[model samples]
Every structure is written in C-alpha cells, then in structure tokens.
Target: MQKMPQWADVVLIPLISLILAALLSALVILAIGENPWAALKLMVEGSLGSTYAWGYTLYYTTNFIFTGLAVAIAIHARLFNIGGEGQAMLGGLGVALIALFIPWPHWSLALLGGAVGAALFGAAWALIPAWLQAKRGSHIVITTIMFNFIAAALLNYLLIGALKPSGSMEPATGRFPEATHLPTFQDMFSTAETALFRGAPVNVSFFVALLACVAVWALIWRTRLGYEIRAFGQSESAAKYAGISPTRIIVVTMLMSGGLAGMMAINNVMGEAERLVLNAVEGAGFIGIAVALMGRSHPFGVLLAALLFGFLYQGGAELALWTSIPRELIVVIQALVILFTGALDNMVRMPLEAMFLRLRPAPKPARKTEPAE
Candidate 1:
C-alpha cells in the first residue's frame, strides 16, 4: 500500500533534497561572481582533508548531536521545545558551579557529575513550560521562546554579580580544576612531537555524543515509555482511551529533550573551554531544528544531518577564510540547505511520491471468461 519504500522515504528523499540544494547553492555562488567549484574544493579540503580538519568538524558535530537529539525527542512527542538555547545556558551554569566548587578526584568523575548537573538544570528549565502547556493550555512554542531570553538575562546577571571571579572582568567562571581537564584527541592520539588533533578542540565529549545517539535510539524504539510517548503523539485522544496520560507524556518527553540539550554544555564548556562563558550555546539550539527536520526526528537520521551541518559549519569557515565569499554567505548557504530540507521539503517530496506511485504497476484486470474455461 505504500507509495514509496521505507528506505526511499528515509534515505532517497533527503539525498535528492540535498542534491537540489547543492545545485541551487552552486548557481547562487556563480551569480555572486565566485567560482562555485573552487569554493567546493576548499570546503572539502578544509573540513575533511586532514586530521586537524576532522577534529574541528567532529567537535561541531558533537554539539549538533546533543542539540539535535534534544529537538528530535520533543518532536516525536509532537512538542516544539524551542527553549534548548536557554536550557543549554542554564546547563552551562550548572556545569560551572560543579566544576568550580567540587574537587572531583578525576575527570571521569567530574564528567559524570557534570552530566547529572547539566541534565537536571536543562530538565528544570523545560519543567515550567511543559507544566503550563499541560495544565494551563499555554502555547509551548511561545513559552519556550520567552524562556530563552530569560535564561540569557539570568546568566548575564549571575556571571556579572555572584559568580564572577574577583578582580577578573571576564563574564565567565574561572578555569576548572586541572583534575577536571578532559583528555583531548591530541593527548589520546599523539606523542610530544607529533599531533593528530593538534590545536583542534575535539575531545572525549564526541564519544559521549555518539553514546547518546545509541541511547536515544533504544529509548525511542525499544522502551515502553517510548511507545506511550509515540502513541500519545500520534493521537492524544486515542492514547487517552488506551489509558495513557497526556500530561505525563508531555512533561516527561520535554524533560528528556531538555536534558539532552543541556548535556551539550559538557562538550563545549568542560571539554573545550574548561570554563563557562556567555553565548556558549552559539545558536546550536536553533540549528537543531533544521537538523531534526532533515533527519525526520529519528536518532540515526539526526546523526547524519548533524554531521552534514557540521561540515557546512567547518567548511564554511574555511570558505570565508580563503575565498572572496563573505562570511555571511556561509549562513545564507546553510539557510538554503535548511530551506530545501525542512521548509520546502514537500517541494521535492511530492514530485518524488507521484513518480514512485506512477512507477508502481497497475493492477491486472480479471479475465472471467478464461477463468471459467
């Protein structure tokens, strides 16, 4: 009964969409008086040519994985938790507090502690919005959006007033204890003279992101709660009739979403900066929307989409550095990808669906006379 195979729906559609986006992007570059092919070469060379480049690409990909999973989880429950930006900010605050005050004997323990703190803080940020949506019928999108600004302001106040290290003007916490310093790729892969990651910021957090992808997959496809969440999402009325609680599903799904979003801080703050700073989330929260859309809200899809965006990010930086293209153009290119993949998805999908339907063989007519003979 399906017009397209499941493989085609999941893989072919996105692949074609990306190809179209790329062709259009190339035209745009040519129209702007730049060499599109050259730009492409530079992007590949810069983002994937060397271990150094892969380090940066993977580092960005790690952040995207966390945020993408966060968005995807809420999306599965038919909820739009746009407050990832704010939740991540609060998660950083939690990380800062733990890393600065607690003297963990080792980075492993510190990492565990940081994960707990980040998850709790992120979940807390989403709690009120989820409650309001479930209990008061408030719009989750508006409430979560408002919370982003509130989180920014709250972080600004705390960093400027209470948490700022004395005699330091920087609006960030002090460097974390040495014991909490994570092992970098350079340390893991190189000697004193030779280096793999070199100056790149990729760290153990990348592994954490990978593990999270697996965890999310299991949660979505292998767990009872996940079934209830998906059932509620598919039809609230039907789920209610089946004895599933809508309010409970909404609150729990948002909590998991926010927790995933918050854990992103462990990568940027603990693994990279070794300190909490303002704007550390760096719009990864918003980019996650596009990632989730392109991935169709599946964990495996999210991982691939996250890597693609990560390539765009790291490669775009290289493009800006080496070509006449303005840095803003990189953002424009990213937007176009998001446009074709997310907003304009049906533009590509509908045609493909029609073609596939037509390709399906027509049902043969019955031969009644021949059958009787």
Candidate 2:
C-alpha cells in the first residue's frame, strides 16, 4: 500500500545515487585517458587500508557529523541556516579564548569549558538572525550568510591584533598550552609493538561527535519540543492554528542549530589544530548542507553520509598524490555526488518507487456479494 519502504528510502536511494555518480566519474576519468577501475582501487586502499588512513577519514567525518546535525535540526524546523560558517568561526574564537586564558589543570576540564564557550558564542552569533527572522520578518538565509562575512572579518582582525602572539608573523593564535592538548588516537591505541594512527590528528573529539549524533537523534525524535518542531515544519499555518508560536520555534531552533555547528570547533580547534587559525572552519559548514541533504536530515543517515564524504576527501587526496588525476577532478567528483544526491534526488526516487510498486503483490479480489451471513 505504501509507495516504497522506509529502508529503501533511507538506504537504497543513496546507494543508487553513489553508483550513478561513480559511473559518471569513471567516464570522466576515461576521457582523461586514465583507468577508472584502478583509480577506484587506489581510493579504497588509500582511505581504508590502515589505521593511519582511518584516523584522517574519521577526523573529517567528525567535523561533518557536527555540522550535518546543525543543518538537519534546522531543516526539521523548516529553517534554512546558512551561517554555520560564521557560527563555527565564533566557536573557534571561543575555544581560543578559553584555551589561552584559562589555565586548566587537565585537558578534560578545558574540554568542558571549551564546549560551553563554543556553544554560547555560536548561539550568540545566531541570535541576531534568529531575532530578525522571528520578529522583523527578515529571511534567515540572508541574515545568516551576512553574519558569516562579519565573523570572518572579526576573526581576521583579532588574529592580526589582540589574539596574535607577540612577534608571530602567522595569522593564527599561538600554540595552545600543554595542558590543553588532547590525546590523539595513537596515544589511546598504540602499544610497544605497534604504533596505530601514527602521525594522524584524530583525537577524543571523534567520540564527542558520536555522542552528538545520539543527542540530536534524541532531540529530533524522542522529545516534546521535537514534536513541536516537526509539526511546525510540516505546516506552519496549521501549527499556528494549533497554538505553536512561530517566533519561539524559529528562535529556539536556530539557537540549537547554531550551537551544534559551533561545537565542531571542539574537534578542529581543541583536538586537531591545537591553535585557532584563520579559516579554521575550512568550508565544513557548507559541506554540511550537502551532508544533511544527502542524509535526508536524519542523524543516523547523517553519520553514514559523513563517513562517505570523509572517504571521498581522504581518497581524493590520495589520488592527487599518487595519480595523474588533478585535485580539481576530485572536486568535480564530489560535486557530481552532491548534484545527484540533492538536486536530482527525485530522478532516482521516482524510479525506485515505481519499481517497488510493480514488485508489490496484487491485492486479493473481494468475495462475491452474498446474502447476509
């Protein structure tokens, strides 16, 4: 009776999209006089061959997870949050300030403080746009994007001025103190016989990202406020008739979305970079939009999508290093994936739905009319 099953919607469509993208990408490589099969093998080996590779892949995945959740939560509220870049920038600033000013006795305490600071600053940055959209009828997308540029300019000024260490020429804050340095995967998994995740930057923050996945899942599907959010998203007019305040939902949802985006700094700043740098967010915010879209805005889907993207990123880098394929080609491949998964989603879904409908068993015929029995 259903057009298609839930599993098909969540898993099959994405799988088909990936295949289509891969087929197109293979043609592109063949046109360039390269072997597509070899390239695929190389990518697999580079991204999954060893713990060292997995370390980098998972690190990127962690960033995507946080940002994807940000976008997903906003989508559920029918709000488009395009300011994750700015909010994450502010989050990095928060992390830098806390790391530099507070002399924590341990990394654990610093991490807790950094998370709070990052979330607060990120939420504060989103507050203006949320207010404008909720109260003044301004568009959330426009306001949030404008805020990104503002955040960038503000970060530039600080890095070149107050936040910069004395006599450092780089446009980045000085190294974080020793106590604030997070433990890497190598430290956690290595033994005297083997050095796993050697030279990899992945750290404790990856677990934090997983925890965030759980939390977002709970917030979106397990709570009362989540129901209200879904209701508002499904039909704003109906929600108003049902007494759900549009202004409150908009403000609260944006705040939560921004907070999730900002928390990404806990990985890149507190965990990987160990210092606040210019452009530390590195376009992870925008990638999150694609991630959320490809994931259908569900937390578990986001995790899987993030892992796929992480593989692409790490694999693409390997291609550039080991093959004649240009890094721009990798970008094109990633774009193809995004294009198919997002803009062309209906192209895949419609066919699958039709196929499922055909495969469904025909219903039994009604019994012939009989006298009341």
The 0-to-1 C-alpha lDDT of every candidate, in the order given, reads 0.89, 0.90
Task: Identify the runs in model 2 with alpha carbons over 4 angstroms from their true place.
Answer: 367-373
Q: What TM-score should be assigned to candidate 1?
A: 0.95
Estimate candidate 2's alpha-carbon lDDT, on a 0 to 1 scale.
Answer: 0.90
All-Cα superposition RMSD per candidate: 1.7, 2.0
Encode model 2's per-residue lDDT on 1-373: one tens digit a residue: 5799889988899889989988999999999999999998998899889999999999989988988899999999999898999999999999999999999899999988989888888888999999999999999999999999999999999999999999999999999999999899999999999999998888998998899999989988999889889999999999999999999999999998999899999999999999999999988888788788889899998999889888887888899899999867766766877799888999999999999999877553334334334
Pairs with steric clashes in candidate 2: none
lDDT (C-alpha) at residue 341 in model 1? 77
lDDT by residue (1-373, candidate 1, tens digit) is 7888898889888888788878888998899899998999999999999999999999999988999999999988899888988998888888889999998999999999998899899999999999999999999999999999999999999988888899999998888999998888988999878878898999998999999999999998899999988998899999999999999999999999999999999998999999988888988888888788788899989999999888888998898898888767656766776798778888988998899888877664445456776
- Backbone clashes in candidate 2 total 0
Tell me the deviation in Å of residue 218 in model 1: 0.4
